[model samples]
Target: MAWMSWTLPTAMFFITIAVILISMTAWQIISPCIERRGFLPLATTRGDRLFIGLLSSAFIHLAFVALTDVNIAVATALCAIWMIVLMRWG
Candidate 1:
């Protein structure tokens, strides 16, 4: 089946996204977040950071694919680090 044809990396990517969404939902239900000014120029909440991080990560991955020979594993690792930083202190 088409849905069953995912490679390891494809499966991992979706699984990671699902886990992040589930955890974020639980965190919001447990203790809500307050917007704050971080290293970023503007104040943002968790959701904003997630959106920004993911958007930038997509561009980074596209750039890597279009301009370099770097492996996707490297891009994924960098994206993960970027997401963590933005979520914690963007």
Candidate 2:
């Protein structure tokens, strides 16, 4: 859309989010998950953990952008790692 700025990084971010959602849907359909407790304070299903991870990662990205002059790639990498850990054992 002309009203929106579709830069490469922005486009990639959205595309990645779409892909993850689609994949997660397929995964749930193939093998359903159950709620379980991890390092997090509450028991949660895979989808719940995913939602939390993504939401928190957004905050992490915003914090990086707002607070530091560091490169965005660093934040992205950190988010990726954090999400993986969260998914595995949140």
Candidate 3:
């Protein structure tokens, strides 16, 4: 008998959800700073900042994975750092 392993798509589906969850959690933690910076909440005007944050988060995670082969935990941390930097700098 042989054991069946998880497929790549299955792993990717869970990873995608994890990334989104991490991004949303990071956004929530930064919501106050965002408001202080005069950016509207996610409910207002299509959330331009949120969109930009999400895009930057994805890129940061991908780049870290590509360069260092880090696990999801490190990738998430890097994404959070990128989000904070972008919010502060931009």
Candidate 4:
């Protein structure tokens, strides 16, 4: 019954959007390097990389927010592992 907190969900929604925007902007700025490396870049007119990045960032932040509320150390480790998996498999 206690889990029905409106405030937490609202905060998470806003925070996720902010994180996605900031991350996407940063990705766009560094897209040239990403392109040179043969990865699809955010600056591409095709928009594939931008879309993927936004989606992945949303999940990443959501996971971080959920796990961090329980344990900071575990959340940090999870984030690192998530990043590695995304870079290797995505």
Q: Which has the greatest lDDT?
A: 2
Candidate 1 lDDT, tens digit per residue, 1-90?
Answer: 355778898899899889988998898889999999999999998988998999999999999999999998899899989989999889
TM-score of every candidate: 0.84, 0.92, 0.42, 0.33
| Candidate 3 clash figure, as a count | 0
Q: Rank the candidates by lDDT, best first.
A: 2, 1, 3, 4
lDDT of each residue in 1-90, candidate 3, tens digit only: 997678997789679768977876786677633333434343321145556778877887778778886687888877778667655544
Query: 1-90, model 4: which lDDT tens digit per residue?
Result: 558567986899789768966876787688733432224443333234445645675676677677666654565566657555445444
Best by TM-score: 2
Which structure is stronger by lDDT: 3 or 4? 3
Candidate 2 overall Cα lDDT vs. reference?
0.96
Model 3 scores worst on lDDT over the 10 consecutive residues at: 37-46
Each prediction's total of clashing residue pairs, residues at least 3 apart in sequence or on different chains, is: 0, 0, 0, 0
- Candidate RMSDs in order: 2.2, 1.6, 8.0, 7.4
Candidate 1: segments with Cα more than 4 A from true spot: 1-4
Number of the candidate with higher lDDT, 2 or 3: 2
lDDT of each: 0.91, 0.96, 0.66, 0.58
Error of 2 at 32 (Å): 0.4
How far in Å is the alpha carbon of 64 misplaced in model 3?
Answer: 1.6
Q: Over all chains combined, what TM-score does candidate 2 have?
A: 0.92
Residue pairs in candidate 4 whose N, alpha carbon or C atoms collide under 3 angstroms: none
Worst 10 residues of 2 by lDDT: 1-10
